[model samples]
Target: MARVSQEHLDARRRQILDGAAICFARNGFHATSMQDVLKEVDLSAGAVYRYFSGKEALIAAIVEEVLGQVRDGFEEAALSSPPPPPDLLVSSVLGRVLESKEFLTVDGRPAFPRLVVQVWTETLRNDQLAGILHDGYSAVQKTWGRIVEAYQDTGMMRSDISADRVARTMMAAAMGFLAQQALFGPAPHEILRDGLRALMSVRDPYDTTGGSQLG
Candidate 1:
């Protein structure tokens, strides 16, 4: 007769989402069913349905959770006390993608990349999922656009290039790197570190000759 506490309800929702993520990560979203999620969670049909109406709802929740973390990561970097160097900021964000426990499979592989590919494929068929992904990417691009403008104003980045262009380019590069990592294993951190340095015009740490300096 006792009512479920708010914390308990939230925990249950998270449990269901986690199980769904694992299922979708292993099997493509189209191949995954509500029954698969129920079995993964070891919960009854009614119990799982209480949190998510169906597989689509569960996929939405998973995408939102992943996108939320990405947005928060960029926001945090932008608002740092002493703003991180461009290369560091980019490296830091990508590094977290490599390190995030939430994205890892039980066998210690990065599951997010596979999930991302599945989501992209599903977006072709599912309008709702496409909209959700579009909104998430828009939010991230807007935040990065602001950050790029701020860097330009500070002379840390080239003012000649458009902030919107730079933001889009950066996002594309990040996504490309993630896709590569997800398909293969983790990439050397130095590859991303150096790549961001070149893209953002950050000064090379190894170059002691101060011919070209970064703001």
Candidate 2:
């Protein structure tokens, strides 16, 4: 018998993970079982287990995959010419999060938000998962902090505030929005856009540079 190529193995693993994500999103983590994943993938038990040892392993892979997509978005934004303003930056990132097909149901509802909340709950009871989550958030924070600092240097953001703090605040707000969206569907884009602009200290349109003071 001929041995399977590495590319085939990788493709098989990705296929299983995709099916597992759909199952977890529909039935949630605890409610979802390996059998559910197997059925979703239409693969034999042996084939599924060859990629992930258990549900926990599948969950870990899903988290890593999601985080990798987020990291790629950040990198893409950072490399763009005439980089987006802080507000646009935040909007861009969150837009990608909300619009990602990887985390959305076929009916246009978000799946990842529910899964993320489930993971947060799991982290409370699982120390290993907790560490993984903490590490992922830390890396994301560092990336955002760099962006915040650049904006501050250009006087686009308040210098009085700590870059790290701003980054953390933005991250928290984004997570909150995700949770809210998952529960109530998406808020108005304009409302979200304005709120992010306010948070990022985008210059007031009516305020002229060195304008005469009001009498």
Candidate 3:
């Protein structure tokens, strides 16, 4: 038999990861069996081992992959054209959360969200995961912070407002909204839009009614 090149190995690994994503997203990480993924991808159990050591490794890979996409998305949004509006900044972050559903359709409803929620809980118990999740959140905050700074520079926001603080608060609000959505199952975009409106309102503190302040 001929040897497979590194490229071939990596391609196969990606395929396995894709399968694992579907499994994790659908079945919930704990509920998914290696055999389930193997069957989904039509790969033998032994063959799958060549790509991942075990189920836990597969879950970690999925986390790393999804989180990487989110990080990349936020970075890309920073470079996005038209200069991000405050509402759009929140919209972008919320959009990414909703996009996790793309991976969830593979196994079951609430699959990827459930896994991420579990990871959030696990972070409370595991220092390493906590650090990873925390850093990921910080990256999100920084991305939004840059957008807020841009808005401030253009006079869309109050010059005195701190972009970093606003960004951190927005992301924190987003995390809370995600938790709420997971619990209540309101329309996905509903919380996102509402949240963005609330965040944007901070920039406009006065209303036609003298007593009404946006902030």
Candidate 4:
């Protein structure tokens, strides 16, 4: 018997993952099962099991793939000679989130945010999943923290506050945006960018008079 080529094996693995992603997105992690995945991918038990042992394994893989994009998004920005300002950084990152195909469902809905809500709920009961999520989030936070530190050095951000706190606060805003996106319909990226700019701006965009400034 001939062996399967490496490309074939890789393709099959991705097929299983893609099918699993759809199942989880549509039915959620708890509602989705191995049998559902089997039906979704039209694969036998043995074929699917060869790639993933169980549902959580598939969840971990998919979550890692999703979070990896978030983690890697900060790479080039983190190394800039003069780090991006906080509002620009937030806007740019959220803009990418809005544009990424990974963040959309087959039906073009922003289901990625909804999927993240499910993962957070699952983490309460699944320690391993929590660990996976925590590690990924921490990595992303560190990237933010690095930028915050640079901002402080350049006197762009306050030097009195801790970079970790600033990073965590920014992460909170991003998470809140995701929750809002998931709960509501599609929101324009300008909402994030403009909002951040408004919060940081000394002059109120609405105030036409130069004498009137934002507090």
Among the numbered candidates, top TM-score falls to 1
TM-score of each candidate structure, all chains considered together: 0.86, 0.82, 0.71, 0.84
In model 4, where do residues sit more than 4 Å from their true spots? 1-3, 102-108, 202-215
Better of 2 and 3 by lDDT: 2
Measured over all alpha carbons after superposition, the RMSD of each candidate to the real structure, in angstroms, is 4.0, 4.4, 4.4, 4.5
- Give lDDT for model 1: 0.79
Model 3 RMSD, rounded to 1 decimal = 4.4
Taken over the whole model, the C-alpha lDDT of each candidate is 0.79, 0.74, 0.67, 0.81
The total of clashing pairs for model 3 equals: 2
Candidate 2, residues 7-112: lDDT per residue as tens digits? 9999999889878877787777789889888888899999888878999998888887777766667667656543577566766777776676545463576666
Indicate whether candidate 1 or candidate 2 has the larger TM-score: 1
Q: What tens-digit string does per-residue lDDT give for candidate 4 at 5-110?
A: 9999999998898788777867789898899989989999999999899998999998898778777777668999567777777768777855764544746776
Q: In candidate 2, which residue pairs get closer than 3 Å at backbone N, Cα or C atoms, i.e. clash?
A: none
Clash count per candidate: 0, 0, 2, 0
lDDT of 4: 0.81
> In model 2, where is the ten-residue run with the lowest total lDDT?
206-215
**Candidates sorted by TM-score, best first:** 1, 4, 2, 3
**Ranking according to lDDT, highest score first:** 4, 1, 2, 3
Candidate 3 lDDT by residue in tens digits, 102-168 = 4555323545555566667656666766676777777777777787777666666665668888877
Task: Give the true-structure RMSD of model 4.
Answer: 4.5
